[model samples]
Target: MDQTTARPETQHQSVTFAEGLTLDCGRHLGSLTIAYRTYGTLNPAKSNAILICHALTGDQYVAETNPETGKPGWWEQVVGPGRPVDTEKFFVICTNVLGGCMGTTGPRSQHDEHAGQPWGTDFPPVTINDMVRAQKRFIDHLEIGRLFAVVGGSMGGMQVLAWAALYPARVFAAVPVAAAAYHSAQNIAFHEIGRQAIAADPDFWAGRYWEHGVTPERGLAVARMTAHITYVSEAALTRKFGRKLQDTAQISALGDRFEVESYLQYQGSSFVRRFDANSYLTITRAMDLFDLSADYGGVLPSAFAGTKTRFLLVSFDSDWLFPTEQSRAIARALNHVAANVSFVEIKSDKGHDAFLLDEPDFHRTLRGFLAGCAEHAGLS
Candidate 1:
């Protein structure tokens, strides 16, 4: 099944489940739509299905060209015919999560209850568990009884952990890369700064930018630029840009003189064109409120009680955002519960973005884990 070809099982699709999803904040939506894309073929037994959860800004176009950006999929490097998550052997499903702007029910989506206006500020706040719950509904809609594995990184990783914690029996294997059970104070602070940047723009108009026919592009770009700095390490920034002048040897007070500054500007400007500002606020708030221990009476191990899912938790050495300690803590909790788990910390200075980059050792680790899980699941 070529990725570019449109098929019932391989093309982009959306389903509005009339289950009337209720948010963690106690607000309820009349209905919910989940936009998703599938790749490869499902085995007759339906045991070869793997759900690939996306990070904060990622969409469902996991292994194909994105219609919005016309660029290759975000995880195209690691999820193809012979890649780590090889599509040839695994039925891959990726979805635009709840509170997502890419065709999923989010701040930008229209609500019938609101007279067909966009949800905007009225969209209820969501949590990681909420996103996982929505994914579960979508999975059930597809009639997949159990997933072979659930894999993700960053916020995607957060959803993976939530899935394994909330519905342990339905998941055979789980891989959560570069993520923690809870967002740290530093992480929340960074997100707050980004949110503040978005809200401070005059064009925001109290989250009514959509109604005003204007967007907070400036504020959104600033937020994206600020957030981008935390995605890479100091070592990586220095190595790649290093005070190198954007042009000839002349420094200006205008402050776009350095290559790094120009690069951040480009990243920020490009992001606003594809993302909505209100959606940014909604998703970051969800990430901030994600705490696995909260549901387990402050005992992280209790969350995994009686869990049968196998876990492979991977962290990067240079990922200060969610460092090795976070992964080790998760491993410790799983060990306390006597659950099957493995922990790996790959050496890399690529920062939190290492999981998405081409790291051979990381790829090998994923392939090895998936192969082991396949054997355990009796997949030929």
Candidate 2:
């Protein structure tokens, strides 16, 4: 983990939607353009397609150069040519979500008409359903009638659930890691605090500051700092930093006067430089509002009713953001509906980020589940 040089930027191509399409947020986002990238070739039957949904801060640059920061793909460990995803066998596709700033249509993207400036504060509010709907359009545009599997973690996991609930027939299997059907109260509160931090910054200017050659860097940095703390476990922080001071002068401080504080500060600062503030606000809000039970008459099991898609839900022991109980709840509901589902609560001290990091146990479970999916799909 050398912090010397910056990562390489990932280039992306633009995709536009047809005219007269309305978004779920009650706004007309006409002539929408999205930035995305793809890997591997689709088989002649188009049945080897796999969709890799990205997390809140991720984009379509899976296993490719990151356009925002010139570096290897964020999930390169699991999504390359002979990796767990095995691009040699599956046509893996990843895209920037509709409300993301990485390349998809978001507050940072320019509106089609009306002076052709950045949408900024005028950007419509987006929901998880909206993102899934947009993805459906993208898949259709590619002539992919069905996906062999939909896999993701965190916010990406939420999209997997949305896809299963909204378009179950189109998905053969799903892998949702470290995610919940709905945002917990604690998670909602954390997101609200981050939103407040961003809004309080004078530079935010109601999310319209981008066009003015300004950004709410301080506010975004603070928000990232707060969220980063929750992504890792207390055990990890203790083992890695454990009150070890960066220098003698800093040790005299009252709180977090350790190497971890400095490390988190760097992570926070670097994040603001690469991500947009308004996009953060939009995506977090979408996560907060996601509730599969609401659409199923308050019956979580009903959400998966009549769905033939197999499910594999994984949770980390240290993941308080979406605890094991949340994963179990989803499993229980899927069982009630007689849907094929498997649940695994991995032993880890890495918290919610264990799925993204190199955890041997998590990888083993993922590999097994994917193998089973391949078998079921007859993709020998």
Candidate 3:
């Protein structure tokens, strides 16, 4: 495999895993490719690199315009030059995770052994650790010894934790925001509903939608609507819509009448335009299978035993989906293992999505944490 790095300014690049990658499920990919993006510059010492992982539905476009959406990056406000991540001073890298749809090897990507056909449902189920393993390969391709920091929110946060635990020496600092060490039963149930919604769509064609030249748009839309509700807080919904009708002063239509309903409908419609239904199933299953304790003989603290990686865990006050309790649980485990850790729960009604929003306190907390980490790493 060619081990050359993409140009520093490359917004999107692909790295082929020619030796193929074996997933946790015992499925071996004959060949794999990872799509990624980079920002800022890697200093002479190469100690200024930061890996920014994305959440469940997010792709590699971190602080640049998304070619697919024709819109500014999802985290543009928080990751540009001089922002919290400080791209000007730190080289930032974000990759579309395994089982993602954005130009990465996923259900939508072509299968090497089967020419002109996508893996679709045949794509093996993946776990958070598998995603991290693939990313480690990507970093090795760049010839970087260790990352200055690994930062992510939600599922991305899970990846951060995996990096710190599985490759402690390779990470100097780790930040897992709005994330949990394992998916809760309620979370798994919600995901199951979404997956079922997609499967039930006639167009899904038993995960062979690609062959049928049709997409499971309606099913995917419903799934997005359900997942979007979990991303935001109930308080936020009430504040933003407050049972207000979409248009008239009184109720009229039977479907999507309220403002919140209309908003959810728009979100669902927009999501299907960019996401693949089979990819959604694969990724959500991976998230649901994440269990740090399982790898450590049912002892969660043992997972972080003797770890030297500095840790910063953040949670939102209203993020009931992956609430403050989950972050506190991780903090307790880290403390038990004598790990260096700091945890904070920001006061916000934005819920799990607060990490992506323009929350002043969240930004300040992140900026301070990264600054301290950079100083400790001796990166001027």
Report lDDT per candidate. Answer: 0.90, 0.85, 0.89
TM-score of each: 0.96, 0.94, 0.96
Give the C-alpha miss distance for residue 24 in model 1, angstroms. 1.0
lDDT of 3 at 210: 79
TM-score of 3: 0.96
Model 1 whole-model lDDT (C-alpha atoms) = 0.90
Q: Candidate 3: which stretches are off by over 4 Å?
A: 1-12, 248-253
Query: How high is the lDDT of residue 122 in model 2?
Result: 74
Write model 2 residue lDDT over 1-380, tens digit each, in one string: 10111112533575677653477768787755556677898999899888999998888888988856775787888888878888998999888898787767887776657565777767788889989888888888888988999999999999999999999989999999899999989999998888999999999988888667899988998899889888989998898888776665343546557788778888888998889898999999999999889988989999999889999999999998889999999999999999999999999998888888898777777778888888988887
> Arrange candidates by lDDT, highest first: which order?
1, 3, 2
For model 1, the superposed segments whose C-alpha errors exceed 4 Å read: 1-12, 248-250
Residue 20 lDDT, candidate 3, scale 0-100:
73
